[model samples]
Target: MMKTKKLIIVGASGFAEIAHEYFDADTEYEVVAYAVEEEFLKTDTLNGLPVVAFETMHQRFAPQEHSVFVAATYTQLNRLRARLAAASKEKGYALASYISPRAFIWRNVELGEHCFIFEDNTVQPFVKVGNNVVMWSGNHIGHHSKIKDNCFISSHVVISGFCDIGENSFLGVNCTIINNIEIAKDNWIGPAVTITHNTDVAAFFKPAKHEPASVNTYRFLRIKEE
Candidate 1:
């Protein structure tokens, strides 16, 4: 078994609070501190752990003896985490990765640091996921797919085999990317949109909306919304 460390989590509030639960359940981390971006901190002791000053956390808990994880969510999860990661790396602290015990990952998969893979996600063989990525619930990451750094993927999204998603993209819920396609950088694919071919860089796609047909002559109270 891997030994536990006296840990500190950056981004002490909001979704970081929610992520604390998973670490709390695992024996691999003996969480000892929480730190934020200075402006949002309020006297420490998040979930009973001391909220240490960000700048002095290393002095108090040296990096060689302890490690840090950035727990911020996807709204600004990538950018903020990347910033703090640079800070920690300079101070000799290692960025942590968390894969939920309930997630299913095949052999030969490569995941970079600071990734959070939540429950019910299937990462197939020969897949590669880059740094600071967040894979939410029930995602299907097909064989040989590559998701670049800093991407946010919502629940139930299907990334088919051999597909490549560029860096910093946002994939909405129920999004489907067809096999062998490439979704370019900074793209925003809306929920339930099926991507069938290679998308241009910075492409934005939205679900198609249809107007309701004329009301049925016999239907009185069940008309569509205005």
Candidate 2:
């Protein structure tokens, strides 16, 4: 078999570890090292690879030889990840995309550069996923949905058909967006929130807290004392 491209993950966090595992097992990119900011650089190695400083990573791992993947989470509404991805491109390194083999992507789906789609993501036909987008596992993206750039979708998000998710938006886990809804840019959707209609710019929707139970589970279940 031919040799695969070398990859350098620009993070050492939990998300980076997941990224490494997926890319190493499924993709043609071999993860050779990890890169982080100088101040945040704690250890010399991660996962048996050297943890290089992001400031001078290009010197050690040349852009022409190794590609980069910014394995940042949804920090600062994905602005930090977006910035790092852009910076890697500016440094002349190609950005790598990770699409899990377990994902079910329709042939008509259009995915832009630097995207990360985890396992069990069902992307329907005509779904347009923009650049620098990250979708966690088990998301059901319906047909004709348009997810714009720099969006971070958590696991189990159900986006119905004809929905448009705007840029720099963060969708938390277990959220559902109904059909034909247009989510605006910079929106922060908390877990379990359902969107049935269009939203304004920078909309923030969080689920309401439920009242605590008056009695314990044993009393509720009416179990006899042992």
TM-score for candidate 2: 0.97
Cα lDDT of model 2 overall? 0.94
Model 1, span 103-160: residue lDDT tens: 9999799999888888899999999999889888999999999999988898999999
TM-score of each model, in listed order: 0.86, 0.97
Candidate 2 Cα errors over 4 Å, as ranges: 1-3
Candidates' C-alpha lDDT: 0.83, 0.94
lDDT of 2 by residue, 1-226 (tens): 2338999999999999999998888888899999999999999998899999999999999999999999998899899999999999999999999998899999999999999999999999999999999999999999999999999999999999999999999999999999999999999999999998899999999886889799877788998766
Report lDDT (Cα) of residue 103, candidate 1.
94
Candidate 1 residues lying further than 4 Å off, grouped into runs, are 1-3, 207-226
- Supply candidate 2's per-residue lDDT for 75: 90
Task: Estimate candidate 1's alpha-carbon lDDT, on a 0 to 1 scale.
Answer: 0.83
**Cα error of candidate 1 at position 133, Å:** 1.5
